[model samples]
Target: MIVETSPENFQVWVHSSRALSLEEKRMWLERMRSDPAAHPKNRWGRCPGFRNTKEKHRSPTGRFPLARLIWIDWDSQADIPLLVPESKPSLLSHPSRRGSVCHPADPCRYHFKKDNESTTDFAYALSLARRGFSDDQIRQRILSERTDWSNHKGEKESKTTSIAPSVVSNR
Candidate 1:
């Protein structure tokens, strides 16, 4: 769930090519090729999807970087994880143990995975939501989902108690 809050300078750098030099253009392309959030194709799509440099280097596998996993829960999720494709991230001042669940603004190096056996990224969780899996099923797959993050901090719904929203919703 990449909520791009790119500053004006970054926006200009991304949308306008006239102000950049040849070297700058090369570097920007390299950056975009390596990073998906800034990649125009990813931004062009309606759903949040995996973006990385895998398509631009290491033999240029013929797949669009934006063609990866799709995450459409960006609008509703209380928190969305952010992953930077850069080799060296800058926002690691306070890294969270939950790698993929980092604050979207805080840059973190998230190793995105496709398998369901071990990997647990919010995007993958959103994928499960898109696939029609129940919230409990997702919770079983990812324990961090225990908190009802959709509600306010003080109004959080607890799953263990009788006041759990799932039970309430059932009623």
Candidate 2:
């Protein structure tokens, strides 16, 4: 049921969506241009090459021509256009293997496996927040989690607390 399309074909896909109207498609494109969360800071780490601009031209491949128009309309302030390829032969048979198991309705699954590490970070942060952790605490936790603590021998040696504190402290 998942029909894949390139940036060139994005408009076609959007128009073909049974759930979305032409106005809705326009609105979604507008939101995507202004929203940093939608566009993201990292290109390759998130949805890559999606440009928000106002250029009313095609990429010679007919991909996302409307996106180019949007970019031009916005005065070219949005993210670059993403070049998503058509469904691969291998994936044609298994449509569900593209990303995580979470529903598209969930913010955590919005971009899916596009950025697995970032998604993990977001999920961890969300879990910590739900558990009553403050933003700073959650950030610290994620940063700590991402750090390679096992490789930092000096840090480990310094922080290790023992029942006989004096013995370990002296080392």
Q: What is the TM-score of each candidate against the true structure?
A: 0.17, 0.20
> How many residue pairs clash (N, CA or C atoms closer than 3 angstroms) in each of the candidate models, in the order given?
0, 19
lDDT by residue (tens digit), candidate 2, 112-135: 233445545555544444444455
Tens digit per residue, CA lDDT, model 1, 1-171: 322222111222223413444444446557556443444332443232433334343334564443223223333423212333447456766643333333344222133353432332344454444344465655554444433333333222113221223332443
- Candidate 1 residues lying further than 4 Å off, grouped into runs, are 1-120, 144-171
Candidate 1: residue 25 Cα off by (Å): 32
RMSD of 2: 19.3
Using alpha carbons, what is the TM-score of model 1?
0.17
Tell me which residue pairs clash in candidate 1. Answer: none
lDDT of each: 0.37, 0.38
